[model samples]
Target chain A: MDKLNEILLNYADVDEIPDSASFRKDLGLSSFDTACLITEIRTVMGISLEPADFIKCKTVGALKDYLNTK
Target chain B: MIEKILPDGSKVTAFPISIPQQFMFFMSAQYGAKYPVNNIGLCCFIHGGADLEILRDALYEAISRCDTMRLRFTPDEKYKILQYITPETEMNIDIIDMSDIPLEEAKLKLQSISREDIPTYNCEIHKISLIRFKGNTDGIFMRLHHFAMDAYSTGVFLRDASEIYLHKTKGTAYPKPMRPYLPVLLQELQYINSPQQTEDKDYWFRSLSEADEPVFTDYMLDNRLTQQQKKNPSQRFADIHSGSPEAGTLIFSMSEDESKRILSVCEEKQLSVCAFLSMGLRTALSVFNNNETDVSFKMIVNRRGTVAEKKSGGIRINYFPMRSIIPGDMKFADAVNEISLIQNDIYGHCSLSFWDMLIERHKSMPSDAKPDSTYDSIGLSYQPPTEHIQLGSSPDEVIWFNNGASMIPLYLTIKHRTTDGGFDFIFEYRKDPDPVYDLNIFFTKLRGALLAGAEDPDITAHVLLKQLKITDEERKGKNNG
Candidate 1:
């Protein structure tokens, strides 16, 4: 979560990104930014993810669930 | 007789158009006879009930405010000059009843209408129509030639028209008239004849003389040679100036999240969005051309805000060539930064007209060598965020489409939509037999390359090229031959 917060910081204010916040609708992460976040997640959390997966998991909590499954 | 009252309460019979307008008029006369070139069209869909009479009056009022809408082109020996006329000439908004037609059929009809050509040269270059659909939905189609207005002017017209419509509907006072095009036109004329133009001419001549030959031409030549050797070659050839060419558009968008990330990257790198996108395009093209070191393409720059031409309401756009050389081992971030610097330098001198550049290039070309007419094969335009206007109860949907014939083979317009904070990528390309490049595949790879670069900014461009595995399939035949 802290790592996710760090990556999100590049795009939005730290306070803006919450567990329930949607990356696209709420945070307005562009396609390139989402790609960067996906790469960062793989590098930091050691979880390989696809852009489609991130798109599907719109919120941080959903993303965590997907990561747990992975 | 309709009269235009000057600032000092004097009447003027005729006025000259701006330099850009004159340029467009001449170019259209030379090239736009077969198809309507440089025509901009907008379709605004209004929902709920709105008075048609009030809407008509509002449109007329909008036209009355801007001299550009009331302009007609007069041909001279050398150039077709523009003259503003009075509204006494009949300018009726064509109202079509689409309520009786099926929705699909109505849409098909609308598409056909959009393809229809308007008066191109030495004529009135603006028209408006209203289409009434079933269930309280109405659509307004406004078409303006590039000589009269640009993309920015379209927004301004819509905003003012809507404001006037709202006021008229409520029986309120009309809004103030917009800044006329005469002042802007005069300003542009002064700049065109100034010493700065001479300096610009010199700068362009030096730049083009020093620049490398376009890489796409080489790619096409290689492809053509390969095709000639094939036993079952495709019947179609790659011709830049093929008559009866078909224009097609491919649109893609970046998600809000992805847009935000790119913005963050740009902000951190001190690069403009346009520069960042251009780098991505350069990198992608390099990979596509089998790791070509240098990629060159023309880019359209709007000179409306420049010191020479500060007024914003008319056509002030010109195309200039941009080249980026990529080292095989350079990191993606470094490549982007380097390209950004090059872009800044090119943009600083973008005020130089493309026509002037061509004339300069033509002078230096050897008598035996063919004149280079291939620069227009590809172009990139980055449209900044435009002011959004609301027409009565906020439109349920707004559709903007370009109806003009494409002057280039492949033109990419990257528009940043402020309402949604998203990017709209429009790729308008000409149809050719045996296309030099597969546009769909190219766009997909472009998106992938940009995403990959964003993910691992430290990765060298060479590695990205390897991943993409772009090769000269067209060159394969030539090698065999």
Candidate 2:
């Protein structure tokens, strides 16, 4: 599975991720949750981001690509 | 009636104490009224489903049980409860058609109730207004006497009424009040002359003495209404301009990737998300004020840890003013680390009252340190999301009451896990009496500063502003050129 699918399956409770599944709206992720997640991904995938960097990453797929580079 | 425990230790029912004493002795001897001391009530937005008759019935029931609701008091020491007063309670109910009434109209209607001319002990009840929308609903507005209750206590009363309504609708047994109002008043008076009274007085004296000269923030905004001025209810809601410069809640959403990044940062810094953000806020606010010497803000300790206190719950909070005094030569990270040290000591020495500390210091100082108002603003840890309790339905969609009173300049409320990784803040200010639009400007600068710091941990206020390009173009050109 790709990083995005892996994140969804491992962390989220839902089956079959929808296109509209926003980190805040669908996953019930708060600002803190987003921060922790970004920090974890940075360590797990060897990438780094600024605290406000998540403000730019809106979705799972989008986040996966951003992480792929760093 | 004064519950006097005499010299022999026997008690006597003495004559009523004066109204001010009633305020001083019964409620907290401290001015418990929300400052800008108008009518005492806060957040008085009414909801639909409230019938005028039902609300009236609740008020009548409350008045019938607590006759002091109608009894007016003179401020004199003779402690006279005057009998010749007119109806001390007043109410206004406006039936606002749902579609025609906008949110600002509703908010303005609620904001218009004033307490400038009200007697210290008399009741002021604005009529419950009705606003009808697609759903079958109504709204109520209230301006109760501050002497009678605080906002938290009033919320309890409203909750009781709501429960009563639900019970009556479903034909359930109506619960009785735990104790009568007058009996409670009498019980409270017993402590007035007790040995603990000295401690209480010392507490007040300390609080006043510690705050040498109160700092007032002037938010520039006009909120005064002309004698003949009419409110255009159709316009946008008027903002409460604060005269005080203060910082409030900072809210923003983060993405999954961003969340992970924040966690890594927290791990690297060995700080919770809240602590990290708080450090950032401290750094930013400290830099913005150009006061690189010291930055101070209060940290709230929620004492609701034990179950017994939770059962007969009262707001048991003691504020610790955490001060970060940076050395003349130190980096931002070093300043934050020092702030963390202050927080540790604050939590350790938290036993002493900030009020008492002031009193101890005041004993050595000369008089004339008192101010009309104290500290301009307070910093609060936000109400936790897990503990968020909605009393009933959210406030109804329409509001209309007609005494325009102003709130104190800067009242701040914050919610977040200080030990963990989340923070949200809310700031309330008086839009009308403000001389500078400080709150808005503060929030704007804060967001800029925090984000700038987040990008680079070593970022200073000057660097942050330079990064954001907030400096004058000419200055920038000169520096660049």
Model 1, range B29-108, lDDT digits (tens) per residue?
A: 76654666667766777777467778888888888776667766553343335356555335789788898877567666
lDDT of 2 by residue, A1-70 (tens): 2655655543343556664566655664433344445545555656676554554566666665666666
Evaluate candidate 2 by giving its C-alpha RMSD to the native, one decimal: 15.6
Q: What share of the true interface contacts does each candidate keep?
A: 0.00, 0.00
Per-model clash counts, in order, read: 10, 54
Every model's Cα RMSD, please? 12.4, 15.6
User: What's the distance in Å from true for residue B134, model 1?
Assistant: 4.0
TM-score of every candidate's chain A? 0.80, 0.68
Summed over model 1, clashes come to 10
Kindly list the per-residue Cα lDDT of model 2 for residues B347-395, writing each as its tens digit.
Answer: 4333344445445544634353342222223354433233222222553
TM-scores computed on chain B for all candidates: 0.81, 0.51
